[model samples]
Target: MALPAPNPRAMLADRGYDSDGFRQDLLIHGILPVIPSRKGRSVPQSLNQKAV
Candidate 1:
């Protein structure tokens, strides 16, 4: 059987989802991915730059 489509608010993630591509996809799908970015890497500008 095919997997069910994720809820719009559901968090979709994987280890690599820390990258920009995944984050953009989440936004496009109207989902909120709570995936924390990998350590030592700079946080995404669109997400954290304004907080600085």
Candidate 2:
């Protein structure tokens, strides 16, 4: 059987979905991706410092 259409505003994700390619694919499909960045990758200092 074929998969049903996803909601226009739905979020799609997976643990491996943190890459730029995956995020871009979600944008192309008009869906939001709530995937967090992989660890050890540097993020903005303000964002990370504040968390610490």
Among all windows of ten consecutive residues in candidate 1, which has the lowest summed lDDT? 43-52
Candidate number of the best lDDT:
1
Off by over 4 Å in 2: 1-5, 12-14, 44-52
Write candidate 2's Cα lDDT for 1-52 as tens digits. 9685655554544445567676678679876666556675576111122211
lDDT of each: 0.60, 0.55
lDDT per residue (tens digit) for residues 1-52 in model 1: 9686656565645456687787778779876666656765675432332221
Q: Which pairs clash (backbone N, Cα, C closer than 3 Å) in model 1?
A: none
Clash count in backbone of candidate 2:
0
Model 1 lDDT, full chain set: 0.60
Alpha-carbon RMSD, candidate 2: 7.2
The candidate scoring highest on TM-score is 1
lDDT of 2: 0.55
